[model samples]
Target: MRLRVFEAYRAAYDKSPYAVAFATCFVKGGASDTLAQFKIERAESWDVLRTVKFASFSGLQTGCIQHFFYNVVFTRAFGPQRTMLVAVRKTLAECLGYIPFVYMPNYFMLKSVFNGGSSLSEGLGDYVAEISGIMPNRSFASRVWLLCRSAGPLC
Candidate 1:
């Protein structure tokens, strides 16, 4: 049974990686939010909207963006070799470049839009505020710098 399931999954993944990833991440994200609501947040009831938002975000961001990043960007830049140096470089690139620039911006934008914001400007405002820990009008470089700074001595 397990072998059959594995083969099925492998076939699905091989056939369409992005679709499989989207489905997988969508389920995983919804499940995680459900678990967090019950266990960590201790909510009395399920938040359907929150679950939807998380699932959608995970499907789009982790599924598509992460797939592209790890498979294409990382492979092209770092090669297929596995080493400590490569690991460190990958980590640094993800943290400094991807997370700060791509991921967080998308997250904040999605969050704002999901939470009833009227515009992308509002989302950008929220992103700047969250990252810079100051006004919502900070420069782009400043926001990135502040975010990287919060990563502690690694920056």
Candidate 2:
């Protein structure tokens, strides 16, 4: 099950060369510190998600790494909010500059598949919109909005 989810995530992110580069940057320098930072950020996001009644093991599994590197690092450095959801949205928007917009939704979709007994594409369009709104930047939000517009509703 873990392997399946990981493979799905890898496939999604691997589609983008920039994501690969960012991931390489994350892993090569300060690997241990980066991992520890990731873990702590994951725990923080889990705590917030749990509080918000949005908790899911799949969300944790898929989003934790992203929440760590993307959300935590950038937010700590220059983003407006320190909260988990805020960080996530900011990170998603920033990543959209580098990776395909489908990547994040696909990650959530895989989580839904593994943990929620849903299709890989199920509920993705909505989730993408929600995340886009949470993002601070209008440019990235517009891009995500365009993607969501093109994506037909998924049942």
Candidate 3:
């Protein structure tokens, strides 16, 4: 079953990698948000709208951006080589460029738009508060720790 699924994915990816990437990220976003709501947040009911927002943002924005980053940027820079040096360089590039520059800004913008106040100034304020750890009680790391604790002792 897994092999068949992989084969199907491979076939689809070969034809339209960007579409596959979008779909994959969409599903991932939906699933992760669902889990967070039910398990981590411990919501009594589903928040379908939140799930939709997450899926849409992840699919429409991050997916295409990631596809371009990996396929175009990294491929052009690193070539087709799969050596240790190339692998390290690519990893460094992803860490240095993608995480800080692309991912965090998009993530914070999504957070601002959805969770924070209506106005742009309010959103920027929220972003500043979050980044500067001014909202100590509502820190991202605390949430992650809570999530890890919920998972099990192994965490």
Candidate 4:
């Protein structure tokens, strides 16, 4: 298994980042779902459909969307030659802009999936309830967000 992983890693370097990101992120997404299902949750049977859905969404978001985001932010928005301040500024902007638009929706969707609610309305209600329940911990989350935002790894 280690040998195979090593060979895959070595092989990836020859390909474009987009291709590598899509493949690896897809694998990682599926692997994560498998771990959650079989290991963490200790489920009796495989949930193949959920695993595939998670992987597809993960690949689409982490692989494809991220590529476009970086291209636009770095190349088109900020230009190629970036100063530290400029990069920091852009990163902060992205962090602020990302929460409601990207992070919240992704979080809600994934939570809805894992929650196993039968209907969209039920899942959405649960999501809203849980989010509101977490309001007390908002300070802690804010601090973590600030730290992460400063570190500049938004996606």
Tens-digit lDDT string for candidate 3 (23-99): 99999989999999999999999999999989988886667788888778987998757666666666667755776
Model 2 stretches astray by more than 4 angstroms: 1-94, 98-100, 136-155
Q: Which runs in model 1 stand beyond 4 Å of their true positions?
A: 134-155
Residue range 99-153, candidate 2, lDDT tens digits: 3454466566755664564586675755677777777566776777655533221
**Whose lDDT is greatest here?**
1
The digit string of per-residue lDDT tens for model 1 on 13-88 reads 9999999999999999999999999999999999999999999999999998899997789878977666656666
- The residue-by-residue lDDT of candidate 4 on 66-113, one tens digit each, is 766766654576665556665666676566665545656666766576
For all predicted structures, in order, the TM-scores are 0.81, 0.27, 0.71, 0.62
Per-residue lDDT, model 4, residue 25, is: 80
Question: Could you tell which candidate, 3 or 4, scores higher by TM-score?
Answer: 3
- Give Cα distance to truth, residue 77, candidate 2, Å: 28
Any residue pairs clashing in model 4, and if so which? none
Predicted structure 1: lDDT: 0.84
- By TM-score, the better pick of 2 and 4 is 4
RMSD of each: 5.8, 16.0, 7.3, 5.1
Superposition error at 65 for model 4 (Å):
0.7
